[model samples]
Target: MKLLAGLTILMIVFVVFGIHTQQQILGLASDMQEMVPNISREINNENWDAARNDTARLLEQWNEIQDRWDLFIVHSEIEQVELYIARILSYLSSEDKAAALAELAALNTQLSHIYRKEMFNVQNIF
Candidate 1:
């Protein structure tokens, strides 16, 4: 009983220390899942190599996450994130990438503003 208690304590400690790291891993996995449809679009457009590369990157992170949680993530929001990544990665040149990234940053800023606004409204009600 004492040994079991000690193991449980250690497990809890490890989990507490690693939750953020695990979440980052999950975030990456979510990005990969989101990118799949964008990748399919690229494939349909006859960009096989680019599509395959994008798919591989996503699959690598996704498979790693699968090793952690059997279910992976069942959220539709993950698909949106992946699509965002794919849209940004579509740029072929470095300059294009920078422009794409800038646009993404702006989009994210807008999303955060909307989210915060909603959150504040919710909080004000209580």
Candidate 2:
């Protein structure tokens, strides 16, 4: 009876941790997604300075969250995001609108994929 109670408590704690992890991942992904469009618009308008600042801010935010993210997300996925951000920064520096936009799209897609993959759904269970 004591063993059974302990197991049940452990399961409850695991479930709570899983829910919190999912929420954090989703929230971070959503925040990053929201910034992408604004950066894209800045790029479209040829506002390089604003775009650069936004990209820097994005990188800063990523840096702040990445250690926590490393605990729950695959390292390769995290690395891919870092790579995309670096490429986007490079493109922005060169004033390459096409390339910058392309990278931003890729970054958005990656973030969407992360959240979708992390979602606690039937599809994910399989």
Candidate 3:
């Protein structure tokens, strides 16, 4: 029947949309994750100026993705990442390299968590 065919089409579209949404979210997380190593290198080299600049750039990227993700993801998890960024910024301002690097590591973990939570897996669905 035409009705049955139409319903199947609609269901297919819905499933595709859900998968696409998760891909976009994961893509954003990947972008953030990519920045980790460069920031870590800057910190290790004691290039405070460059590290600060990179962190600022990373924060900007985070803001750009944050709004898009809000619709699909948990707000509190997002907040935790924002908090980590703020803490990193604070440490940078005080020229505390060790503390800033620690915060950076924490930020990486938070980003990974967000990515894993959004991944299209059975565990995440429940």
Top model number, TM-score: 2
Better of 1 and 3 by lDDT: 3
**For this target, which candidate reaches the highest lDDT against the unseen true structure?**
2
Give the per-residue lDDT digits (tens) of candidate 2, residues 1-126: 999999999999999999999999999999999999999999999999999999999999999999999998999999999999999999999999999999999999999999999999999999
Error of 2 at 64 (Å): 0.8
Which candidate do you rate higher for TM-score, 1 or 2?
2
Question: Which stretch of 10 consecutive residues in model 2 shows the poorest summed lDDT?
Answer: 20-29
For candidate 3, which ten residues in a row score worst on lDDT?
117-126
Model 1 TM: 0.35
lDDT, residue 60, candidate 3? 99
Compared with the true structure, all predictions reach lDDT values of 0.52, 0.97, 0.89
The lDDT, on a scale of 0 to 1, for candidate 3 is: 0.89
What TM-score fits each model?
Answer: 0.35, 0.97, 0.87
Between candidates 2 and 3, name the one with more favorable lDDT: 2
Can you list the residue pairs that collide in candidate 3? Answer: none
- Backbone Cα, N, C clashes tallied per candidate: 3, 0, 0
In model 3, the Cα lDDT at residue 126 comes to 85
lDDT measured at residue 109 in model 1 versus the true structure, 0 to 100: 47
